[model samples]
Target: MLLQSPWPSRVNDSSTKATHVFITDFLKEKGVSTLDVLVNNAAIGSECFKETFDVNVVGTVAVTWANVNRVLR
Candidate 1:
């Protein structure tokens, strides 16, 4: 089954440690032991480089790290 959960609307919000924990916890609560794939498509086009980088890079890394263990090889 493909389970899709709502992510934080703001990239900055989604990048936080708390958000990471919430994602994993949500999955666990839903009985998801493993994931076949992960798609980090959260990004934004902004005049502020920091904002863009935070969402595109830091956010991706944070989310990936949070769920890496649950992903299937």
Candidate 2:
């Protein structure tokens, strides 16, 4: 139950940062909650080294970090 996911944007897209911020902010505004298991489902296969790491690894970590300690009690 992550707030934001960077998988929507193409791999290596810088806009993912903004999306993460937006989702976190949205959750805060509405008093949303935090998440436990972050399923890294959305990933793109690549023929190069950079794309594979950026999408599957970097993006997944970035999105998951945004949800940490964001739960409102």
Candidate 3:
């Protein structure tokens, strides 16, 4: 199934735990126990500054933190 899908698949909400769980399962399914690198590049320049900051700053931090602990040494 994954082989049929396109590369560079995206996870919409990085801050969501469900997304993290999905990622954990997906990686496991692919026989990956840990991540090698995590790139937090979720940036946006929306009209609402707070919203932009939440997604770009908080969300990125949240995602990176969640994945860092799981990455391979």
Clashes of 2: 0
Q: Which stretches of candidate 3 lie over 4 Å from their true place?
A: 40-73
Local distance difference test scores for all models: 0.64, 0.59, 0.70
Model 2 misplaced stretches (Cα beyond 4 Å): 1-47, 70-73
**Local accuracy of candidate 1 as per-residue lDDT tens digits, 1-73:** 1235353233345478876766667578778776667545455334565677688889999999999988855
So what's the TM-score on candidate 1? 0.34
Worst 10 residues of 1 by lDDT: 1-10
- What order do you get sorting by TM-score, best first? 3, 1, 2
lDDT (tens digit, per residue) of candidate 2 on 1-73: 3435753433333588875775566567658666444434355344554677688889998977887677432
Question: How far does residue 71 in candidate 3 sit from its true spot (Å)?
Answer: 30
> Each candidate: RMSD to true structure?
13.1, 14.1, 12.4
TM-scores of the candidates are 0.34, 0.29, 0.38
Candidate 3 per-residue lDDT, tens place, 2-69, comes to 34575444566746987787679778888988888765445523356577668888999999888996
For lDDT, the strongest prediction is 3
